[model samples]
Target: MSTFGKHYRVTTYGESHGRSVGCIVDGCPPGLQLAEQDIQPQMTRRRPGQSALTTPRNEKDKVEIQSGTEFGVTLGSPIALRVLNEDQRPKDYGGGGENIDMFPRPSHADWTYLEKYGVKSSSGGGRSSARETIGRVAAGAIAEKYLKDAYGVEIVAYTNSVGPIELFPSTKEHPSPSTNPAFLDFLNKVTREEVDSFLPVRCPDEKVSQSMSDLIGEFRDREDSIGGTVTCVIRNCPAGLGEPCFDKLEATLGLAMMSLPATKGFEIGSGFGGTRIPGSTHNDAWIKTPAIAPGETKPNVKQPKLTTKTNHSGGIQGGISNGAHIYFNVAFKPPATIGQAQQTTGYDGTEGVLAAKGRHDPCVIPRAVPIVESMAAITVMDALMAQLSREAARDRLQQAGMTNPAMMTATGNGHA
Candidate 1:
């Protein structure tokens, strides 16, 4: 489906070579300050032509707010946003002597797209293009704004690995970032400004970022592409946000991240590393909440009275948030459209060599950072709204004297 989220629904439209690409953000709460400037930073970060490491497709990706706001305030209606496709080169993928139109690019959506629809775009991957994510990023930015205003939620993502190189490579002694104190410290304090300071690669480590950049350059020079992993953290999230069973927080997060173009895998919290440890070693033990000073306020709204000594659960337990920092990693496969020749079958079932043409990124992890953060924001926002609705309904019932006596007794006995 082109649309996502139960509450905070976002519906995106347009194709890679279309006139424009954008999204409609529905179910936003009213009276929040918003403007084009609010959403442009993320859009700019996601745009191409940022450096030699990325695609040379020059697009400013400037967003225009078409409706659903008045005098900088959201009207609680669907807000439409649009960004024009200024540097379209549809002919590059077809026409002339280029045989790209005949053979489906290996590992691309070309074959499956045609097999599913019985038709395909002659120029690019059509709706499957990375350009389709522009709407997602825009919609995510709006959701992020609301989250930041209401709950002080902060979402940040950065390159964790490019090819075999990693910012914090796992060793036998430290198989996961959860086992490394330094990595935990970095998550606690790392900001978007610090992340962007190491641009082009966005690994946040000076030496590692340079290594990632050099690797991307090597692939670009060879007319090839590479893939990497992006790690994201959502902080100051309130407790009890996720739904149980089918819509568990991590399940929805997996769905959101995997829905992005080229995403190969998604893992949360301790992830795969936790599998190696015993249940006693891997579990997050609970502890008393740290005492606050007389004049100091709580660290954040809805701060839990008790906290976990460890975050092996990634801020979630039993599919519900635990008021801890939530972090996860998303793996993206290498871009399929390369300048190198490959032997493949064509539409007519004939064998041939296909060397694709188009402006494409050698390594997508840098630009993918913002896209990752945006998706996390959208997921959290949707979950938060759903939780808020349920809470309001329960509170109204209690005020109307409809509360169950057993439930009240259980709450009084601290069994809630």
Candidate 2:
């Protein structure tokens, strides 16, 4: 059920607190460079110890390419990759005993997980932990490279909100947030302690970040937590990557976002904003202009011609990419784990009080930016591959001189 994609599906298995977690990507074309190093960068980005506002777990999260490659290039087989649970916590809370069933942490999915599976891991949050995302990020990194090399696709994401620290739409609307000098300086220079010291309102929004911090400080003085959203951008997507009827580009993107932990909502392009517009008001008009040199163009040649007076389509339409910039927003809920003590139950399954004794984030949204981008890259790459594979099939048919109507097309239908 973890499978994603019609042709190039990636199924991930294992638990966060399990002995290991891994992913198997079926349908990868052979001969691409596949190595542990290729997947490590993305894993490192998702690693917990990167900042101060995150968990204290100092896991290297090193990856091992177990199959589908020989001497680095893929063997045209399923790619299996994994990371060991090297920093697993002991099952004891030191309160006389570790009654994991009874020592449930507040805001965590422990109760729900137990209800569904009847058992859970005592180490971390078990399967509900963020650690499960490593497999996804790893697979995504590979997909990202393939898409980039094959179709010039680029994927990126930025922190849009951290509790009250939200990004207000620029009156001038620059190309992106991370591109601004002040914003980029803040992100690259501000330490976790600096960011964590603020209230829920001020992480990225100066005013809100400040005000939220004051309120959260009062709450922190009392012990509390918060939530927010992240914005992802995908560019240079090729046209016709996704199919119609089903597997629409936006549909697949939404599925990938929903699959992540703590994601409560999602929106692509003008998402809910289109409701306020009439057809004329919301429609993105097309206007062609003389092509300007886009990137490293030859001195004498202009860039390729493109059109789109507006981006209301979010770069996709009719379930397929229109070869435009694709962007989306993902909403994450407040971290379920909080420091406050609450009334719960014990392993004997009896009523009791619970105080969370482990280290956890008051917010997961800040760190989730990379995860959302990774999933987007993954979905885009898969769709791109499906398009390429179909093209390859058609080419083969052409070589065989199969001119029959059914054999030349990919609709799975034929009639001479």
Candidate 3:
């Protein structure tokens, strides 16, 4: 199940320390403007050696468009993208020195991978490495472009918490949960550029970002690691973007986030914390409001579609979007490949010392920020495409004079 999405399918290939890592994106709408430049920003963001907080593996991770575009525009064909692995140091993971194959690192996929596949790559955890997320980030850039162009969807993710330090926005800053005007305002206006301007840790708050950086440095110096949370928000996503009965928007998002390496948890809207409040206090009450579209004129009248005064549901309800900001948190565990030595059983079941040798991040939250955004964009864009296809079919039926209630009822009841 490496492939994700129904309408906008993306299948990733290659692995860490492999010749290349890439993905083939199928079902992108035709006639959209696209180019290598459009996809490279995220590539650079997700690449290693960006700063001292991450692994020191120097890889430019330049992406090359292998096919599915002509004259800088998409051809509605499967878009093949590839990035060469020029700095692969397989030996760094004991490919020849100590032979990591003799023992599996704790909290890593080594044992499980061997059990599932009857074999495993001795170097860098193979497909389980965070390097595999490169393909996802690459394809997600394309999805982000299309979503922004079509629906003005803006996705932004930032380090919300690192270890025990959490960046809590002031209650005044976020206001009430029923109508989170401040939070909604921030999500609606924040951009990737704005988020990146925070740099190194990408926490947005300067003081907290510095603290997180210092904490990561401490772990790196100690040859240990820590885990944290990345919070993401999706703005301007049209209402009714989810498919029910299994393909729910939240369910798909949970699946997408969980698929990423080192992810431990996913929560949407109020998430687990919401349970603390009573249902009467937590429910999002509906209110009449006018649609707000830029550069488009509309009469100053209430919209036929109502909106929630509060967004405790996290912009989604009953597995469907409700035209509110969708916000969630992704929890990422620390990198398993630390320099610390630990006593562990070997492949032959003999006890031995395991000191992992490799270039790895002490805290993965900084790098995972972009990965979270990428996964969210891919999921939302796919759901949007599915919704559009259904709506187009309904429009065709209407245009053909087949949308009459009686006719629809008769046809559904098999009275053809």
Candidate 4:
């Protein structure tokens, strides 16, 4: 189904070259502080043609709140958002039959999508294109705000690799979770709190960031492309957010990761390498500490109620949040639409060589970070709501003749 979710469903429509692309959020608790600015920064992150490494297709990518809110707040109705395509060059991308269709790029879903659906759109990958992720990212931003304000959840993501230059490289043959700016390891480390800290986020390690940038700059001029991974982490997450069995946390996360374009691989916590480790090494043992402040209060913010010794589970345990650091990695392949020409079959079933037209990101991982974060937020917030609702429902059954449902207050708190 094009739509996803049980309690908090999101039905996204439109296409890359279509008039617009957006999402319709079904479940939202009204009266959360929200504004147009909340979703703007996220759109800017995935916006086409932003940096030298990305495609030059600039589409203002502005957000239009069509429903779900009156002034600037959510009205509990379905939150609908639409982003108009500002800069589009359908002529640049011709495919299938005669001069209309060029050679189909390999590793792209062009043909598979067509084979499965029997029909495709001109320009962009239609729904297959990264352009389709706008609606997801938009919905995610909203979810992020809700979680941040209500439960104080924070999620952050950044580039982790390119070709062989791995930022959060594994340690002792296993992926070690660390909050190193990777790109900015030299100056001050970027954290989840600083939303805009990574602006044009360069490598914290001057030498590394410059070297990577130089490599990208040179390749951009050469019309070549590259690929990498984006690392993301969440802090101060309460335990018991994910549903068991079918609706597991990792299951939901996989849905989001696999949905992005050019994403080759996905991993959470120790991932495959952990398979080699014994249970003693792979298992995460839990401990208790002072209460943590909400997601983004301050360093001195309330003592975190939840704490962990080792985050072997990457903050999630038993298909749910264990209150540790939640982290994962998303793999991306080099942009197939390079300036260099490659041999391929035309849409008409003829052999030909064609250089894929248009501008695109050689490395979508860095920018894809926000998209990933948005999804994580959306999923986590939905899961959180699910947990809270269940708790509320259980309490309702216990209070039978209770007249004041609002007076039910909090269902229950895990610990002091």
* Residue 395 alpha-carbon offset, candidate 1, angstroms: 0.8
The clash numbers for all candidates, in the given order, read 0, 12, 1, 23
- lDDT agreement with native, every candidate: 0.92, 0.69, 0.86, 0.72
Which residue pairs collide, candidate 1? Answer: none
Q: Write the per-residue lDDT of candidate 2 for residues 1-416, one digit (tens) a residue.
A: 66776676788877766788989988777878878887887787677765555667778989999899998898988889888977766553333364444666666777777778887665667667888888888788888777766666667665567665566443243333322345434432443244334423225456665554454444444456677777776766777778666788899999999989888998886666555545684576777734546784232212224556667677788888766668777888877766677787665667877766566666676567667867898788778777888888988888888757665455746644
Instruction: Give the distance in Å from residue 384's predicted Cα in candidate 4 to where it truly belongs.
Output: 1.4
Q: Could you tell me the TM-score of candidate 3?
A: 0.92
Query: TM-score order of candidates, best first?
Result: 1, 3, 4, 2
lDDT of 4 by residue, 10-91 (tens): 8888877888999999897898767779889888877876766677787888998888887777889899899998777776
Model 1 over residues 1-416: C-alpha lDDT tens digits?
89999998999999999899999999999998999999999999999999999999999999999999999999999999999999999988888579988888999998999999999888887999999999999999999999988888999999999999999788898787787888889999999999999998999999999999999999999999999999999998999989998889999999999999999999899889878767897888989878777996454476677888988889988889998899999999999899999999998999999988789999889999999999999999999989999989988999999987667553565473
Q: Which candidate is the best by TM-score?
A: 1
Task: Write down the worst ten-residue block by lDDT for model 1.
Answer: 407-416
Better of 2 and 4 by TM-score: 4
Q: What's the TM-score of each model vs. the native?
A: 0.97, 0.80, 0.92, 0.86
Worst 10-residue stretch by lDDT in candidate 3? 170-179
Q: lDDT order of candidates, best first?
A: 1, 3, 4, 2
User: Model 3, which residues run further than 4 Å from truth?
Assistant: 169-185, 291-304, 405-416
lDDT for model 2 comes to 0.69
